[model samples]
Target: MKAKELMDKEFVYLNCDDNVVEVSKVMEEIRRFTCPVVNDNKQLVGWITSFDITKGLREGNEKIKEIMSSYEEITTIHEDAPARLAVVLTANNKFVTVPVINDDNQVIGMIRSCDIVELLSELYDIKVYKLYEAMQHQLKGVTWEELMSASALVSKKTTGVKISPEDYEANIMNATFGEAIWATGGLEKFFAGLISVGEMVIARKVGKARR
Candidate 1:
């Protein structure tokens, strides 16, 4: 897959002259953590993240340029770059989102960690809901069997709870490989123990389809 295939085109951005107030408004409205900053020449100059904006407000009247991360220091990838490269950069930088630039250095789009994870999930044919619940345990170093046991407890506690297929798909698509396995195991055991005996059978079918 290419970066262009997964990049978000309708992203919010900021101009160098834009004030903290304006930036704050945009971030709030869009619920985004960062925005690309451009110069009057329509060239990419820097990026303003929520953290930078908040710091600027604290300092009172600090220009966007003052708090923004310089374009030179920010890592960028061309649209044609392999999707694996994007995953590597995201993992290495711990970035929630990264900007995409064209040959002219013009900002074309942005890619989020969530998007990459989701793409991988779909390619792997994993269930999103199980993946998410399992990841929480995996992060805590919980074993597969232990994680399954815990999931059963939670399901029993909330019998009336319902998860939409879209939400489930999103979770599976967005989770990493290790995380997906952990989540699948957890959810499979939970459903089997609490809901039905056919849970694992259904999961296996989905897994095969994803491949």
Candidate 2:
């Protein structure tokens, strides 16, 4: 599947002149952590996120250019590219969404992490709600963020090489439980337990579907 097929054309974004306050409101309204930034010509110029807004406020930055990640720093994918690339890009950058650009590098659509996950669930015939329930059960006390952080240690234990703390936090949020376990080489008990539960849930759902 290509990005154009999966990307949402009707999306919210910020212009280079928009301010931190506007960024905050857009994020809240869209319930998104990140947004693409555009120029007056409607070209993809950069990106802004809640993280950027928080830093901008601390620095007293009033303009979008002051707080937004510049085009050079933000990554964009061609609309014709494979949709799975969106998942890789988000995982690598810890981004919630990636802008899809045309040949002229103009913003055309946005591919979100949820989009890829939902597609994956459909392709595999896996029940997403059941998988989420299993994750919630296994991660009762630990925030997904914290469990992600611990995954770095799990990786080290399995591979005998330490993963950067930064990489773990950045990549893990974009990963499903199965992806997380794959990253850790399936050595972590927490992830293994989550997988076991998720498999059982999926099995039950498959049985129900057949019935």
Candidate 3:
């Protein structure tokens, strides 16, 4: 996939001249701690994170320009470039986030590592099989929610398996996390899908009790 296809076009960004308070507001609105920084021309300049905001505020460096990573210290991927480029940049950053830019060096979108994982889940059609693999590994100190989410991918069949209340809390919630990783396209449309999955789990239990 191309960078544009993988990037979140409906993304929030920051201006170098923005203050820490302004950055905080942007983070609150987007529900994301990280954002790309742009110049007066709206060109990609650097990146900022919640850490930067706090550090700046604590140090009395309220202006984003004084705290945001400089353009030389950051990276950018072209919208028309291969998506893998973004993957490398994210992975190199310990799988954080990367910004996408157009030919004019204007910031266009952002891509998080979770986005790539979801893409893989969609492309590979991963399913319940991963859950079994995780269980086999005897993953300890690990919550069921994280396990099921990392393993479960896109699948049409719930297989009539019922999940109890405990299981729902452990697994179903994270099923919603990372932007509902199991379903692509992020957040907005995932609610219906979430409800459908919950109903399926309940139905499975009902069917079992009847048997």
| Model 2, C-alpha of 69: deviation from truth (Å) | 0.9
Model 3, 1-211: lDDT tens digits are 7999998877776887788887787798878878888877889888888898888878888788888888897777889999988877777778577888898999988887888988866744444334344443553344444444422321233434555445544554344344344344554445445445444444544566699
Where model 2 places Cα greater than 4 Å from the true spot, the runs are 126-211
Clashes of each: 5, 0, 0
Off by over 4 Å in 3: 126-211
Name every residue pair that clashes in candidate 3: none
lDDT of 2 by residue, 1-211 (tens): 8989999888886888887876787788878888888877778888888889989988888888888888898888999999878888888887778899999888999888888778866644433334544565665443444444454665576568888757765554455555544554663764574455445445555566699
> Candidate 3 at residue 143, lDDT?
47
What TM-score does prediction 1 earn? 0.59
- The residue pairs found clashing in candidate 1 are 117-174, 118-173, 118-174, 128-171, 128-172
lDDT of 1 by residue, 22-52 (tens): 7888899998998888766556889888899
Measured over all alpha carbons after superposition, the RMSD of each candidate to the real structure, in angstroms, is: 12.6, 14.8, 14.3
